[model samples]
Every structure is written in C-alpha cells, then in structure tokens.
Target: MQSWQKVQCGVLLSISIAVMAGCSASSPYRDRAEDYRHAEPSHYELPPIPGQRDQMPIPQGSTQGYTGDEFIAPRPESMQTGVAERPPVELRKDNQGPWLWVNTGPAKVWPALQRFAEEKNLDVVYTNPRSGELMVRADVGGTPAQRFSLRQGVGRQTSEVRIVSMSSGQALPFSEFDRERMMALEQYLLVTQQQQNGRVSLAAQNLDDGDQVRWVDRDGRRLLVLDFAFDRSWGELQNLLSNGFDEDAQRLDDQDRSQGIFYIHYLARAERDSGFWSWLFGSDNADKAKAYRLVLTPSGDMTELHVEDASGQPADIQVEQELLDWIRRQLT
Candidate 1:
C-alpha cells in the first residue's frame, strides 16, 4: 500500500513539471513585465532578435525615431543584396598555369611588330594598336611611304590592312585574302605576257610560203611556212608562187630602163595571153599594203618570190635554203 501511494505521488509530480514548462513558454513575460508597460510600443511588433524580452533604450520622446529596425540582430551575408560584377579570372580559377599572363600593353607589342615590319622590308613609320603610317619596299629599289591600319573584332580578334601606292596615283588596300589571290592572278599575267612575246617573234615568218619561206621548225631538209591572211586573195597567191613572180621580174627588166616596172610572161598554155599573168601579178596601189608569200623547198633548191609593189618594181628576194636548216637546228 505504501509503495502504491509513493508511485501515485511521483506520477502527479511529473505532470506538474510539464504543465509548468508549457505555461512559461506560452507567457509573453518572464517577471514583472507590467513595470515596463510605459516602454511598450503602441504598435508593438517582435524585433529580429526574437521575443524582445529585452528593450533597447531609446530617447524618452520621439517615437518616430524608434523604428522596429533598431532592435534587429546583424544580418547574415546571404541576406545582403545588390548588383554584383563578374569575378576576375584569378578569383574564379583556383589554379592558373605556371606563367602569369600580363596584358603587355599595345605599346609594347608595337616595337616587336616594328622589327617584324623592318625584316619584311617594310618601314616602320608609326604604329599603334589602331592606325599608323608605314613605308613599304618597292620592286625596283628603295622604299616608299604607305598607309596601314589595324582592326579589332567584338571579341579579342585582330586584323591588319596595308595600302600600297603604285606609280599611278591610286592607293590599293591589300587584305590577307588579297595576298593569297595574287598568287594565282600573277600567274595569269605571266602567261599573257609570254603569248604577246611569241606573236611578235612569229611576225617575220608570216609573209612567205613553205619550202621557200623561213621554216622555224625545219630539220636538215628545206621547209617553208605560209600564212593566208583572211583579207588577201588565195588565187593571186597561188599564181604568183607558181610562175608569175619570175615572169614579172623578167618582163620589168626587159621593158625599159626608164620605166620602173618590168613585165615577164610564162607561156603556160601558149595562148600568147601575157595579160592573165600580168593581171594577177601586177599590184594596184589600192592594195599596196597587202601581199601574200609562199615558201618552196627542195634540199638543193629553195626559191620563194615576193610580188612587186604598185610602182612597177620587180619582185625580188634571195631567201637561202640554209636559213631554214639553221632555224630547225635552234628548235632542237
């Protein structure tokens, strides 16, 4: 009976302790909160420090100065807010490569670039990261002043522009791409120049026929090359080469010493018609600038005949066979 009474007493004591703890937590005051009733804010709210059991001292008057902010605890860093800048690379990356990267400002890069220009035969007039003047070497000799510029892209991109002045008073800007294109364009210029030179060289051979004409590609045997100009008559050319030339030369010599022209006749069919030979071989001053030639070749005999001019002069030329052989030797 005694133990049961003690156990009942113990149980009641535990209940009493719990109820007292709950009451204390629920109460808005610890002791004598009524004494500070004068200090109570008319529009009271809890401070950041929590329950506000502690009142911060304030001036006796001026309720407006005592904002709720006055009693708050210091703010945590995460709570602070404002615009923030992007972090520096040094701060962002834990470890950088061994060598430090410094900007080596545009001023420093200029000298090295200047040295580079000099070696390239370009004069370093003045350079900045932007625009400047430079002297560039010319093909003939010496150097001439030129314009230069540097351009940058949105990112850290860079480019160079060079302007060259030719003897003609115009400036041409050369980009990186222009230099590459010139390699192919220059080849075209070379080929055209060579063709013009070849046509000039072939000019001498145009007036004669093969066998009697100059054979540039000939071997030991005599050869002639003939060209028919689009404007001239091919029949006249044929007759002149066949027998008209020798006949005209002889006729002119026999006619008279006083008359400049002499005529000759080849009695090809025996019609006594020298007029046919004369008509084809004789020159009319209207076509004086025009004439056709033929080259006739036999190893032992080569005789080519050029026609007479409108002045009645004899058609006379002595083209040798050995000249053909000599030209052929050169080709090989």
Candidate 2:
C-alpha cells in the first residue's frame, strides 16, 4: 500500500509541472514586456540582433525624418514613357515623277507594305522581295485596281515607292486617286512603329541604280561629282545657297547661271568677330573672310563642281577640300 501511494504522488507532481509550463507558454514574455512599457513603441518592432536579445537603437539622421511621408521611385532614363518617335516618311515629286521617300531600308518597308495590304483588304497579286516590288490589286469595294513599283533609293537607308493605275495590262498616268493612296501610305508609315533589325536584301540593294553624289580626283585636283544633270545640279545648288548651309552661315555673293558659276563668301565662327564696337568700327577680322567660286562642268551624264579662289584661279588645297566636303554634305 505504501509503494502504490508513492507512485500516485509522482504522477500528481508531473501533471502540476505540465500545467505550469502551459500557462507560461501562453504569455511567454508578458512580464518582461510590461517592465519596458516606458520605452518607445518603435523599439519593440525592430529586428533582433543575432545572438543578442536587445534591439539596436535607430541611427541619428536616418530616414526616420521621412516618417508618414509618401515616396515615389524615380523613372529610369532607359525606360521611356511617352509615345516614341516614328520613322521619317515624306511624299516627294521631281521631274521624274511622284514617289514616296521613306527613311528606311527596303527590307523593313517590304514587310510594312504587306501588313498594309492585309489591313486594307487589298489582293496581293504578286510580290518580289528580291526586286523590292509588290503588285497589289485593290479592286475590292468598287475601288479601281492599281499597281505599285517599290525600289531602293539612291541614298542609304532610303526607299522610293511609286504607284500607278492599271487597266488592260497598261499603266495609266499618276492621277488624284494615286496621290490619295500614296498619302495614306505615307501617313501609315509616319505613325506606325518600326523595328531595328538592320536587315538588308542583297538583290534589292543591288537594285540601287547609282549614288546621287561622288568624289573623284582628276588632274591633281579634287572634284565633287554629282550624278545629276547640269541643269538639275545647278537648280539644287541654287536652292542650297539660297537657304543656309551650316551653323556659320555661308552667303551667296554672285551667280551667273549662263556661266554655270556661283560666288559665295564663307566666314568661320572665329572670324565673325562681333563686338559692341564692331558695328561702328567694322570687324578687326574682316580680312579673314574667304570667298570661293563654285564652277560647274558637265561631264557626259555627271556634273563636276570645281572650287576656285576669289580671283577664279585654283583654290588653296586645304580650303578647296573643306569647301568640297561642305558642299557634298549639303547635296547628299
């Protein structure tokens, strides 16, 4: 009877221990937390230090000053938000005919034209990506059928798109309807986004007839050769001279279309020599003004531009080169 009583007492002690453990687990840190009631409320929310019970104090001059303030992250420079700029598209006409001048390669324009045809519900009768040409018949909805000839431009990364009405296998003259269609294409190109694939068609690139301008050396002198005829070259040069050429501003002095010569005065930015007294006393660097003559010579199909001094003699080598380079840039 004594041993059984001892066993019962041991079981009772185990139960009491378990009850106390459960009560402490329910509010493990209640007593310790009440001891620190006077401390700041934020102190209790800080991350505890590794192997340490105490939390670290907030550093002086920290972001704590921005408490209760709304923050906005800045946008990165590479991440553009607004509508991006589209490729350049222009409808141009010359003595040849009306054509669209798009500042892009034929490869890109080929796909764009296909997409346009699909969107307009036009029937693509034929497509020759090698020749950079697409023959589409837009006769649907009582619209007159037309054919277009797309070709690579003489300049790099440019295309010349031409259109005409077709009837009985004969192409008609460019009409108002053709112009309207061309304008729509131009607008489409202007607004639509283009990819930067840097694609080039070998055959289409070969279709580029020739360069508009070229530089050649003949008889110990450099010449700016234009692939255009003399009349066209003259008209182009006149237009360029009428407008300004560069930031320094080259002005026309005299011109004689009969003689195919233009005299222009060029002033470097340093030679401008503008000052408070310049208007009254003239510029001290007025003597630095350089005058050059642009002489056009017809060579079969090409026109050559020869730079000469003010007196009509051979221009200084360095000055002639610089003038030739500037004129080439303007022409191209």
Candidate 3:
C-alpha cells in the first residue's frame, strides 16, 4: 500500500507541473507587454494651431539657428548713403548763448540775414560772410542800441546767429529783444520766396561749415569724433542730454566727465512700433530700450566717442552704430 501511494504522488506532481506550463504559455499579460514596448504613434496627422508655422530646416553647416527663437536683433546700420534730411529749423539756447539754428548752408543763411537787416531798417555796422559774422545795431526795449551778431555755418550745413549786447564793450545777457530778432530771421528763412531764391553768397562760400561732430572708423570700430577739446566735448554732450532729443527724452543715468564715461538709456526709432496693439499692450517698446555707456577719449584736440554696454564692455556693432548715429544727429 505504501509503494502504491508513492507512485500515485509522483503522477499527481507531474500532472500539476504540466498544467502550470500550459497556463504560462497562454498568459495574456505576457504577450501584451511586448506589444506595449514596441508600440508607435497613429498614422493620422493633426491640424496645426492657428498663427503657428513649422520652423525651417537648419542650414547644413550652421552651428545654431535663430528661426523660432524669441531673440530680436538690433536694427541693422542704415546702408543708404547721402545727406539725410536736415532737422527742422529750431531755436536752441544754453549757457554759452542763445542762437538760431538754420538748416540751410551759410550761403543761403548769409543772404537771408542780410535781407532781414534791410527789411527791419536796422543799421548794419559790419558784415563778414567769410568769417560767418554779421553785426547789426538794434535797440533792445528801452536800452540803447546793442550790437547784434549773427554767426552762420556752425555745423554741417547749419548756422547759428547769436546776438551779443555790448554796453561799454562788456557783453550783456541776451534779452527778449534778441530772441524776437532771431524769430523774425527764422521765419524769413522758412518762406518759400527765400528758400527758392537760390542766391548763394560768393563771400560766404569760403565760410567753413565747421563740422564739429562727425563719424570716423578706427581699427575696424566706428566712433563719433567731436572735433573739440575734451572739456568742450563733455559740455556739448551734457547739453544734448539735458536738452533731450526730438520726441524721445534722453536719460542720463550716470556720468563721469573726468573719466569720460556717460551711462545712458537709449531707444532707437526703428525699434519703436506704432501699431494699435503695440500701443495698447506697451510690450514692444519697453523691451527694446537698453542702456549703453558712451566712452570719450581725447585724441589730440579731438574727443573720440565709443559706445559700450552699461558695464563698459564692448557693445554689439549694430547697437554701437545706432547710438553713435543718434549722438551725431543731436550734436551736429
């Protein structure tokens, strides 16, 4: 009976093993796991989102691509050459003196001022177009007749007429009378008759349009060259920042005239957007404004201006050019 029991146990154990092997061979989870590991996406394509487009393929040898990148570059330097449109004629004053900035060259300004003196019935004491100076005797309010000086050809195709009141050979302060005289001349120059007259003064032809502010390229880097002493250059730039440019106000963050560094916040007109959405959101211009350092170095009598970042590090070439151009336009 014991032998029969052992044979029966062996048969039962073999049958149990066969049943377990059959269950393992037909297991659903075992086969499904392999399919899950090797699964791929469906063949159908989804519609693209509105206002979205696929990025272009990168160039073969390019190490990086800017497409689809949020980075906006500085406006490229204007390649269009030739004289830019002259700034509108305006009246400017500073510690030096009040002067009328005429947009035309000395040739036109000299003749126009001569006509002004004649029309006003003012006594002309001296006239030297070559030196860009004209002295006229005019009464200032109740004061005696003072010597008014009109200087032409101050900058590039520009003129400055300054009235100097000399009492006992001592220069007096410019009064409202002087300003009225300048305003009259400014209006005279703007008239279509005067501008279309084409009467170029032969004597003033020799008057040097003392181009005090200009651009120069040195060692492959562009610079704004001010043909003046360091002290004078500093004063000129300071006056510009103080007076501000056209519609945009120039902000002078910090300045060290002795060290020849001016830290300023600058915004280029090209970077500005006039769209309705841009104005409503105030997003475009706020991000475009940047701070830059203007470094001045004396080169003989001339002062050289170079643009750098706010930290004094070299700025991007395009940004430097734009800043320099802005300075040149204002100073000139």
Candidate 4:
C-alpha cells in the first residue's frame, strides 16, 4: 500500500508541471509588451531643418538614408556671420537732412557710424556740445533757413515745419504750408511791381494766344517750362525765383515735387530789360510789375538783376541736367 501511494504522488507532480508549460507557449509577444509599459521620454527639443527660409534642413536630403546610426555637426560659431553683415539703405532727398541730424547723434557715440559714413561717401558735419538749438542754426546757415522754422508747444511736442507768407493779394502758386499758407505767401514772393504794406503781386495772369516762360539754370541751360510755370514775385533776392516750380531736373515726364525753384532772371538782368517778363505775367499783375536786371559781378557772379528787355521775353527756359548742375555750381 505504501509503494502504491508514492507512485501516485510522483505521477501527479509531473502532470502539474506539463500543464503550466503548455499555457505559457499558447500566449503571444504582446503580453510581454504590456508588462513593460512604464518607460517614457515625456518631451524633448528638436534640431532645426536646413534649406528652410528661417532654418537649416537636416540629413542634407530627407529622401536619403542616414549614415552609421546618426549624423555629426560642426561648431555653430564656425558657420555663423557677425551682426553687422547687413548694409545701409539710402534715404529720400526731403528726409535726408532730418534723418542725418538724428543719425549724427549716435554717430558721435559709435565708431561704426563714422566708418560707415565714410564708406558710403557722404559728408558728415560735427559741432562742439552738439546742442539741438545750435545745430538748427548751423543747418540753416548755409541753406535757405527761413523757409523752415521750429514749432513748439503743440500736440506731442516741438518739431520743425515750413511757414507760409501771407502778403500776396490772397493768391499764391506754391507754398510748403498748404493752400491757406500759399495764399498768404503769394505776397511774400513779393512782387516789387505793386506793394501795399510790403505785400506784392509777383506775376500777372495774362494768357496771350501764344506766350510762355522758360526755365533757365545758372549755367544758362533751357528747360521746358510746363503750363504750371509762372513769374512768381521775386523774393528779397530777385535772382531767386522763390517758389511755384513742380519738380527738379528730372521733371521731364514724371509728376513730382522738388525742393523749390530759384528764378535767376539772369539774361533779363544782363540785357537790361524788365517789361517783357511782366507782360506775360498778366493785367491782374497791374500793381506788381517791376523789372529786375541781374548783372554778373567782377568776381564773375551777379551784382544786379533785371527782368524783361526792349525786345522779347527771357530766353525760353528748361529744366535739364546741365541746368541743375550749373545752378548748384553757382549757389554752393
């Protein structure tokens, strides 16, 4: 009976072990994956791609395979350029003066400003103390200073703007200040022909079937005087046209605005004539009709000026490259 019992126990133990091994073989690899699910990176930063407008793309070409296990890169400093890599831009003529005044301050602090100005071939003016008021005076000393003025106690603060003259008989051709100012300034162009309290009519509105004015430069180059051209009242300086010119030397076919026009009336002065320019002006110009004769000084410059002659009007004028080149030559 004891022997029979031992045989039964041994067979039962062997059968239990066989049953467990069969169950393990029946299960799949997925069961093992669920058991190991605790691993994770959570989040990480990625490198930029090359060939992008803002960044470099990776792998040289995404279509190709990677080398070894991963790729290597060179030091960033070795591939990068400096902050000053970009170049400076040119400014428009009207804004040039103000812009330069601003940049000049920083220029005094920075070595690069001086170097850059020299490289671009521009003139730089520096003053002691660099006070704003003194700078304004210096700016106007060489050019027509009164044309522009400083305004304070308005809106945001103080700044510069052009002032208008209100002397013309409620009429004006051109003024930095809009229409209202132009009307006021028409007199300031100040036609010596007619003067009441120093206000003068500069030109007459006479429209003969065929009559015109010419744009002559200091050098005597003739430019086509468009319909807009008219004999404005000669300013304090008769040689100076004062205002009422559309564009500068480049006005051939383009519609634009120029700084201002200065009518020298050089020939009118040289030829000793005045009536010619006045008649083309008009009868409304009845009060403002005076002739100016511009004579070259011994230094080869104008001493006295006159307009109109016993013969025809001032030589046909035109705004040409030679004209501007010549005028700037004489003025500066």
As for lDDT, the candidate ahead, 2 or 3, is 2
By summed lDDT, the worst window of 10 consecutive residues in model 2 runs over 74-83
Using all chains and alpha carbons, the TM-scores for the candidates as numbered come to 0.19, 0.53, 0.58, 0.15
Count of steric clashes across candidates, in order: 18, 0, 0, 45
Q: Name model 1 segments beyond 4 Å from true.
A: 1-38, 44-112, 118-121, 125-130, 137-146, 154-157, 163-165, 172-332
| Arranged by lDDT, best first | 2, 3, 1, 4
lDDT of 1 by residue, 185-236 (tens): 2343234333432222122222112232233322222333333221111222
Cα error, candidate 1, residue 151 (Å): 2.1
Which segments of candidate 3 are over 4 A away from where they belong? 1-88, 138-155, 192-195, 210-212, 217-221, 229-262, 266-285, 295-301, 329-332
Segments in model 2 whose C-alpha atoms lie over 4 Å from true places: 1-87, 138-145, 166-171, 193-212, 227-248, 252-265, 268-303, 308-316, 329-332
- Tens digits of per-residue lDDT for model 2 on 27-100? 75776666676776654567867787447677577342133557444222223211133248866665545778
| Per-residue C-alpha lDDT of model 3 across residues 1-332, encoded as one tens digit per residue | 99999999999999999999999998886666568778888798899788886588665773222345466675554453223444546666656666666666777677877887788788788888877666655455555355544444335766666667666667777777667766776677678234477888888877544667887777667888887778657766765665553222236777886798887776664566655786686554545668888899999988889988877778766567666876786666
Candidate lDDT (C-alpha), each: 0.32, 0.69, 0.68, 0.27
| Index of the highest-lDDT prediction | 2
lDDT of 3: 0.68
lDDT of candidate 2 vs native?
A: 0.69
Backbone collision tally, model 1: 18
